[model samples]
Structure formats: C-alpha cells, structure tokens
Target: MTETVEPFTWHVAQDAIDDLHRRIDATRWPERETVDDWSQGVPLDALRDFVDHWRNHYDWRSTEAWINAQGLSTTTIDGVDIRFLHVRSAHENARPLLLTHGWPGSILEFRAAIPRLVDPEAHGGTAADAFHVVIPSLPGYGLSGKPTRHGWKVEKIAQAWGVLMARLGYAKWYAQGGDWGAAVTTQIGRQNVAGCAGIHLNMPIARPLPEDLAAPGPDELKALAALQHYQEWDAGYSKQQQTRPQTIGYSLVDSPVGLAGWIYEKMWAWTDNQGRAEDALSRDSMCDNLMLYWLTAAGASSARLYWESFASFAPAEITMPVGASVFPKEILPAPRKWAERHYTKLVHWGVLDKGGHFAAWEQPEVFVNELRKTFAAMD
Candidate 1:
C-alpha cells in the first residue's frame, strides 16, 4: 500500500484561536434549577468557570507552538489523511512501537512520555529499550480526517495501522493502546499481521464469562457484581453513543463547552478524579482535548464509530501474545482464567494500584513499566 506523505505543520492558524475566543465569549447560557445535580448533564456553574478561563486566560497559540515543538508528519492511508507525531530514537537499532489514542484523547496524551519511551536515557533508562514511536490521531479525532463511509470499524482501522507501519518500513513492531485504542490494537494482535510482534493494552474490554468461569468464585462474583452495578448506572453513555450518536453529537459539535462536559463527565466518572476533575487534570489539558474535537468538528464522526461497530463486534477469542495492565477504576478487569478465555496467550497481567481508564495520562510510570516488562519478555 503506497502512502502519500502530506505537508504536516503544527502551527494552528491565529484565526482559529480567535474564532474559539469569540465562541467562548458569545455563549448563550441556559438557566438551571439549583437543586439539579450533575446527573442531568454538565453543570451550568462548571461550564461558566471553564468558559471564563477559556475566554480570559487560555493561550491556544502557545499550545500549538508546544505541539509544533514535537516532530509531526502526515500521510494518506487508503485515501484518508492521517496526522501523527513521530519521535525516533538516536539509536538506529531501536524497535518500532505504534501507540494508539482513544476517544476524547489525541496524540496529545502521550506528549509527556514520548521522549522517555523513545530515548529513555534522559529518563534514566537504557537506550537498548529505545522505541521509534508513531502516535496517530484516530480517524474522526484530532488531525485525522473524518471517514466519509461507514466501514471505519476497529478491524479496518487496525488494517490501516498495519499499512501505516509497513509504509514506514517496519516489518515487525510492538503496539500499545487504551480505551478504543485497545480495541484496535487487540484486533491487530488477532490479525497477527507480520509487523505486529506483540501488544500491551491498558483498557482491555470486558470478556464475557467462559463456561468454566461463569460459575463465579467469591472474587469473580464480586467483580461481576461491581460490573453489573456500573452497567446499570454508568453505561447509559455507551448505549447513547452506540445508538443515537448524531443526535447528541449535534450540540457537542457546535459548542466547545458542551463537548467538554460530554467528554469530561466520563473522565470524571471513569478516573480517580477524587470528585473534582480539575484536581487530577488541569483545565488547559482538558480544554486542549475539547478544542481538538471542536476544531476538527469530529463529534458526530467520533460517535458514528460506536454506531458502526458496536453491533457487529462479537466477543471472540484472540490468539496472540498479549499483556494487560488492569487499572482499578477501568470499565472491567478479568481474572487470569477469564482473560485467558479470550486472550489465549496472555503472557502478562497486572493489577495496577492506581489510575483508571486514562492510565497512561494519569499513571504513566506504572503504565510504562508494565508495557516495558510485557514487550521485553516477548523480545
């Protein structure tokens, strides 16, 4: 698959930031009853505080400059344009590692850890562990162009990544991902393409009970009980995305505040936010992510993925060397036996003491260690 390299530039135009400022200042707020908690949606009070900061103090140009400071490149894979940040090691013998980002996250999440992963020496590690890193914006997210057709399933995305790595002349490489990224990376492992040596996942999807493990041990039963409880209360967002994404996406596509609330709610509910999202993640990082969605107008495109593949992606077996770093507040955690039912060659599985769905962003050291151990063992 021949790929067309594009002129990739990271300097976001000044007009774009001006436009965001105008939108933030011109917001028409709605009144809400004092009694209504966050259950209804984004709290009016929180949006106001965010909007005030965004309008008065936020610096989009600086953010753009910082992103530009990191190396970036663009390429067209199977007709869809993809933008990525490429960080290569000084060691010519470095291994290639393709890192995938999930929903509401861009290549931005990995910015802090890229140098550490690629060079390692500055971070007090050996160059022997160096990796040539490729962090792409998932289709319909950030810089990647939205898919025009309906076939942008995880399988297709995984294949596209295969083409991507091969285009870069990597015949064998390792992979890592979280959230929907884990889904795509896991599919790559299943496909067992020539380049994908092994995979490490932070957010492994819940495996359905195998007949042997269906009869719950006390611990398994507790895990299952906890999962069931979450589904009842917290799974509504998944149902909405999988069914009527466009309807909800309309508001999110237009309003940055709306989009922030929609995504931030999940970040708060899913992560160890300690009841305040700002305590865990800064408003700037949060806004940077929301801005990526707004600038690209990817709300509908992002949600359509759920509607497209949710129905067809059945729980099935995967036959590849795999590792999972199970964070405490992740959507699900499978015991070794249960995980083996799906990941037949489950070589590494660890119970993380901290973090949640956004493990890499929150607990990069823990995530990095697990990833290093898993891939190193396979090598």
Candidate 2:
C-alpha cells in the first residue's frame, strides 16, 4: 500500500449533467400521500418542489468550486481509495482533527463547519481554538472507493482513519462524528488509535441496559421511547438496506428522483425542521449533497455499510477520554447515564438546547463550539 495523497478535483462531464436533467424531467412522480403530515413519507408535492430546485435553481458549479477551493486529495488505504478534505490552519500550533460523515450524508456535511474549525479567530474563537481539519467521505460514500469485498465494517474504517492521520503526519489528534462516523470514532477510542488524544460524539453508541429496561428512570424511559419509535416507525429504510441493498440500488442509480426522494425523506426525518427540511438546511446545500450521490452512483455501495454493521452496534467500554452532545431530535440521543456504561473516561457531557441528527451540517456554530470545549477539556 503506497501512501500517496494525490490532489483531486471535480471535472464532471457535460453528458452526466445532461443525463441527470433528462432523468429528472422524465420522472413519473407519485400521487400525494394519504396523510397531511409526513406520516406516509416525503409528500409528493414536497419532493416535486425539491427536484424542481435541484433541476433548475441549484448551482453545482458553486458547490464544486467551494469544495475544490478548500483542497481535496485521495490516498489508497486497505486496498481502497479514501477521498478527503485536508485544510491546514494558518495557525501553526493548531491541533489536527479528523472529522467523518455518515449515511444520507456526504463530505458536504462538514463544509460549513470546516472553515470555522480551521480559522477560529474569524468565527467567535481565539487562535487556541484553531484546528487543521481532515474530513473524509466514508468508504463507499461520496467519492471514496467502494469496497470490493465483504469486510469493510466500522472498525475497518476506524483503523484506516488512524492510518490516514498518521500518514498525514499528525502525531497527536482528536476525532468527532455523528451517525456511522460516530460509530467509527467510537471504535477509534475503543481501539486506542495511536496519538489520538480524545474523541467526541453526538450520537453515542449505547443501548438500554438490562437494569434500565427492567426499571425505567427518566433518561432510561427517553431512550426506551426513542428505541420503540425507531423500531416501529423510523426503521423501514434500515431494514430494507440491511436485507436488500442491491435491490434498491437499481432504483437509486437509475432515477435521479428516486435517489433524491430516498435522501430527501431522511432529511425531513432527521433534521430539526419546521415541517420542511429547508427550515434547517438551505436548499442549495441539500441539492449539493444530492449531486454527490447522483453523480457517483453511490446508492447501493453506500447502503451496504448498513448491511455490514447495522445489527452490531459493537457496544464496548472505552477507556479513552470522551465527550458528547445530545441534540434534542437525534434519532436515539443516548443519555449520559446510558453512555457511562460504555465510556469509562467520560470527560465532557453537553446536552444542547436545539439541533438534531446532522449536528455539524444542521448547527455548525454549536457543533464547532462543542469540539473546542470538549477537546480543550480533554487535555
């Protein structure tokens, strides 16, 4: 495995763009949902409006330039290509932080937060809060190479991150993530990655303890209720991905509208929005994120991560310093008490007033502040 981080840029062909518009134009849309609310799914009208914006008003060039300006590079690790944004801060003593993204998310999730992290003085923070940030698209997501074999689980990705940071010449660093990235960061702490000082997570990997299940307290009851809701109402996508990723991959890869609705539904479900996902995340950002999937044909390759690691949350007690922020609307915002069962050196615990699943993407200011405070306290 030659460790070479080659600089990369987006040069999407005109034919691909034309095909995307063609597909969007030719979409055979479904009728309105039976319910007024999103009980049935992303309503037909909402999806049509989203696709309209994506087809007409959204500027992929702006997003492409923004991303390419920050600098992107790829390196082969574990027989796969890892695509990442490597932005070194102007501050020489800035700490190195490895950020990761998860499903229904791309490297786009971290775009707003990256500048603030790398140049803290401009964004309500001192030089001390500055960081050299490295944000990688998860294996099989975004531009990263999809795994050709069966063993690319969260732990595998975690080990690869360790290798990546070391290769980038960071002797000591910190990590943070939510969703699958959280799962990988948890593995980094659990595996005790070399020179990793500490880690933070928005969605901690914790389940209801036997005792908590038997006798529910306030936090325990909250965990239980979220669990029940997920099992009953929110887990259809997971079950489908877990059981048959290849089947749905056809729809996702073939139809731009199919791909948009698949992710658009999750956007509505996960964000702290007022009836529409645009209330929390801007239309341009959402469309930018959608383009990554549409262009890469990543529907099944990305979904396969669920097939690999969904059943095994891989709960284990980690001795490294850990910090967490529980947003109000995280699908399963694990309480501190439940988290204590897995993180032995729980250094910082923050329960935020607002925000939801996509912490960095949804509430970047709050997210960057948490990282600063948590890593500062870890030392």
Candidate 3:
C-alpha cells in the first residue's frame, strides 16, 4: 500500500520568539576585532543593528501569516515527517516540479518565486507553464522532524525525496536546487528514477582536476581558475562544519545575533550583487530565514550534512539530461568541459548574466527567466 501523508501545520509558539528575544538580550558578547574586512567576521555595528530590530520590531506572527497565506502543506515520508509548501495550478495537466533547499537555508528561500511558479497568470506567464510545486525543508531543517539516525547522507535523502514525489502521486517530475540542494539534485539524477524526466540545478559539483593536468581550451581554463579561487578563499564554513559543527553550534544556538552574523556574512559575500546585501536582501527577509534555524534548533543537525558528505564528492557522469545556469559570483562554477566529463546528457549550460550562490534569493528574476527559457526548450 502507498504511504499516507498529512498536510502541513503552520504555527509558531509565541514563547519561542520570546525566548529568542531573551537570548539576544542576554547574549554574552565577545570582544570585537577592528580593522578586519568581512573576512574577519560580521561587523559589530551591523550585528547590533540587526539584533535590536529582531528583538524590538520584527514580527514573527506576520511572517507566520505570510507563510499561511501561501497555503502550504506538510507530509510524512519514509519514516521522516516532512514539511513542504505544495502549490498547483488550476490546469489539471500541469507538470510536477520539486524544489529543495540547502543548508543555512529553509523552504523560505523560495518565498518570492513560488507564486510565480504556481500561478503564472499573476506573474505574466501562461497556465501552460505552471508547475505543481513541492518545496520541502530538508530533513532536520525547518519544521521537518529532526533525523533520529546517522545515515541521512545525500543518496539517502534523494531516496526520501523519491518516496515524497511518489507519495504525492507524481509519475513524472523535475528537480531543482542550489547550494546543498544542487548536491541533492545530483543524487536524484543518480537515482535514475524512472519518472524523473530531467533535472535543473544552479549549483553543480565538478571533480577536482590536478593543477598539472593538461589544460583544456581558454574557456575551460578560466572556469578552473574560478574553481581554484573558491577553494582557497570561500570554503572556511565547509571546513568548520565538516570538522567541528558542535563547537560552532554552541555560539549559534545561544545567540540569535551570532547566528544572523554567521549566516549574513556568507550571504553578503556570496550573493551575485557584491557588497549590496542590504540593498539586495531586506533585514526582515534575512531575519525570517534565520528564525527558521533558531526556532527548529537545527544548527548542528544541518551542519552534520556537511561532515557526512564532505568527502563523498561524486562527480556524477549523469546519464539524464542536465541543465545548469552558472552564476558568476557562485562560490564554485564547474567549467563546461569539466562538467561535460561528468554529465553525459548535458544539454543546457549558460554563464548567467548575474547572481551568485543564492540565485533564487539574490537574483530571482534572472533565475526565473533562465528556468523558463531552458525548460521551454526541453518541453
């Protein structure tokens, strides 16, 4: 018999928000180090302003209301109860598309893009292009129940997603993700699910080539140069999370400001629009994403995914048609040649005009446009 899953429950207790405020107020702050770039850390002044607003003015209830307004649903799959926002168009024959989020992120990442995907009419698109959207909080992230076991690696999570899609009765569907979501999509492609037609990803992992390895053409060499830069300068979080998640968890769990700073710095640095996190992302939006981690106590569990998959880097020689929209500011961009070695059915690849690691959150319009164009060609 097929497994039965329930709809999402949207509610956040007042005491939890209050507790967050209490912690922010009682935080035992550390001495600040001046004269350091963002590399040193989130600036003290920026962190303080965010905390003051979080405690004094930010509205958790309104965030909850906006979430409810989206009309999301929750479900249980493969013994892990999952929370997701499922949206479908009025057209009965719309295609199914599963959207997954990555670490330091929640389903909240797609808040702006969901409506456009679901009811394209509202966003100047036709019903023919609508998708039955399934945006799930990865296991141990957001409202999804924390994993009780140790083996929730990428492959295992992909299996769970398969069960989720089948439970929803989607015979054929597409998958898209960024960050770890990109990693998960690679696993889903590897699963070779009979009904998975094609996969779309903003983030694609390439196998590391030796520096002495014979170089490809100029384009490929440029891509390799970009990858090398990322490894050196942009990978500290990976090192910490993969080795000592618990140590970092202590500070993040105790202080909301600490968590915000931890996440905000990365967002500020990695986004497509450099040095414009405030203009690109509002303080409210940033706090809302952080609140998901804070309320769920998912700091360590989310980090552990890094530890488990740190070395399990599979450069998938993907047999299914794969499309990648590469953003310049993306932490790592696999060269088209290197990517070709892994994806046998690579059909679409574009160095996007703009955006960075968090494509949807940072450059939603560019991201949405790319999706429409690529999927249209395949359709």
Candidate 4:
C-alpha cells in the first residue's frame, strides 16, 4: 500500500502563544508545601521561578526553527497520520536507525543526538559509525495525529514502526528507545519483525522471576529495591495517567503552569541533578519540551497511551540481539542477569556512572557514545 508522505512545518499561532502567557500570568498560587524538600511535589518557590522564566524569556520561534531545520515529514499509516524526522547520513554505508521517545518527551528529546549519529565523521566519529536516523513522534504525543478510537497500544505502535521503516525504504534497520519507547522497541524485537536487525535500550524493563528472587545477587537485590522504591514513591503519575488521564487532561490543557509542574517534577526526580531540574536541563530546553505538549493540546491524548497499554507492556523475553545502557539514575535499573532473562542474546551492556530517565536529553554525548558502541558490537 502506497502512503502519501507530506513535508511538515511547525508553526504555532500567535494567539495560542498569547493565551499561554495569559494563563501563566494568571495562574493561581497554591500554598507552599509543608516540607522544605520536593517530597510533596514541585516546590512552590521553584515552580514560581520556573514559570516566571518560561513566561518571560522562553523562545518558541527559535525552537520551531530548530525543528524545521530537521527533515520533517508525515504520513498516514493504518488510518492514522504519523510525524517523524528522517535524517540521512552522508556516509555511504549508514545504517537506518529508528529512535523512539517515551512519556513527557517528544521527538525533541533526540534533537542533539541526531546530527552526531547521522554525520559521525563531523562529530569525531568514523564514517562507519554513521546512522540514517528516523525519530518519530509517538502517536498522540507530539506532532503525530491522535487516535480517535481505541486499541493504539505499544504492540500496535511497534507494528506501525515496522511499517514506518518499510515505508522509508529501510529493508533492514536498527532501533533504540527509552521509557515507553523501550516497551515499543522490545515489542518490535519480540515480534521479530522483518528488516529489524537488532535493538538498543536505555531503559530495559526486566522483572525478576519468583525463582530468581529466591537467590538474588547483590545487583539483583539492588534492582528489586529500586523497583520497589519507584512503585512506592514515583508511580502516582503512572496510576493517574493509566486510570484517569482525561480528568487531569483538563488541567493540563487549560493551564500551562499545571502542565509544566506535572512534567517539571519528573525532571527533578528522574534526572541526575543536584536538587534542581535546571541543573541538568536548561530552562529553554524544558520549555521547548513543554511547548510540544502545550502547543499540540496533547495533554489528554498523550496520557491516554498509559491507559491503553501500561500494564500490557510489562517485561517479556526477547530473543534477538539486544544491547542496553543502564544509567544510574533510571527509575528501575535492571541488573545484567535480570535483563538477560528477557534479552537472550544480550550483546552490549554498559553501566554508566551518570544520566537518568531522559538519557539523550540529559547527556547527549554519553548517549551517542553508548549507541555507537552498542551497535558497533552488534554490527
């Protein structure tokens, strides 16, 4: 089936920008948290400072220009329009690579890594390290069209990715992802889709079996403890998004501050920062990510993904060649043995001393190096 591919240019209406500012300016103040730290959530003082910066200084047009500079295109696949960035490398033997992003993230997450991956020679890498990259906006997340019906789960998204790679004339390709993206890429491996050479994940989701737990090693025990800590402390957003996304969607769409606070807290909790999210991500970068959600009015639509496929994306075995980079600050850091249970042909495993959930966004150089090394081994 031939699909119509159209060039995409991003432009936010002036009125929408004005309205966002008005909302930010008119935001009602909530009482300060009872505690001094961020245990309750984003601290009132920190949020206020961030909101002031966002409203007063953030530049959306510059961000739009940055996006426009990429090879942006959209195509209708399986009755849904998908948006993606297709950047081909100048290197003759460049491998096609599909990169995916997860919740609270968009195609922008991979912006910095794109050029380095696509034109490695220009970035101190050999031509052999080059990759023709395809970074897609997950359905209903960024510029991609939202689903009007049900059944748009990760499995379906994985199938769509296969179709996407095929549509782009990639008969054989590699894949990489983190967060919800890890789930999608893992499904692609599990399904053993044609043309999928292998996969690399920054966040590999693997659970210890009952028997494995019986005789856990030090790393496995630490992993299990981290998983438990995450479920107890950091999973409220997941539950809300999975069960009642629509309820919070109203607030997210109507209030820019509300959306920022929702995502900003995760930045603090998930990133390798020193008590502040800004320490890891610049104010402009955070605003750029927030604008993808704010401009698209994707608050409810994006959250619906959790409702559609969170539980279904639990850890499962994948037989194909696999690589993983376990960042120290990830919500749940799976040990090598634990991941090996699922990734039978685990080829490359790197335990980095730094970085977090948003690997590419937080540490692009380290992230790029990991991908290069991981794929070189598998290649």
Sorted by lDDT (best first), the order is 4, 2, 3, 1
All-Cα superposition RMSD per candidate: 2.2, 1.1, 2.1, 1.2
TM-score of each: 0.93, 0.98, 0.93, 0.98
Lowest lDDT sum, 10 consecutive residues, model 2, at 309-318
Off by over 4 Å in 3: 208-213, 216-222
Superposition TM-score, candidate 4 onto the true structure:
0.98
In candidate 4, the residue pairs with backbone N, CA or C atoms under 3 Å apart (3 or more residues apart, or in different chains) clash, namely none
Q: How accurate locally, in lDDT, is each candidate?
A: 0.78, 0.90, 0.78, 0.90
Flag regions of model 1 displaced more than 4 Å.
Answer: 33-37, 210-214, 312-314
Candidate 4 lDDT tens digits, 156-211: 99999999998888899999999999999999999997899899999998877888
Look at candidate 1 and give me any clashing residue pairs: none
Error of 4 at 317 (Å): 2.0
Report the lDDT of model 1 for residue 114.
Answer: 80
lDDT of 1 by residue, 237-276 (tens): 7788899988988988887767776787876777766776
lDDT of 2 by residue, 146-255 (tens): 99998998888899999999989999999998999898999999899898999999999887767777888887787788878988999999899888999999999999
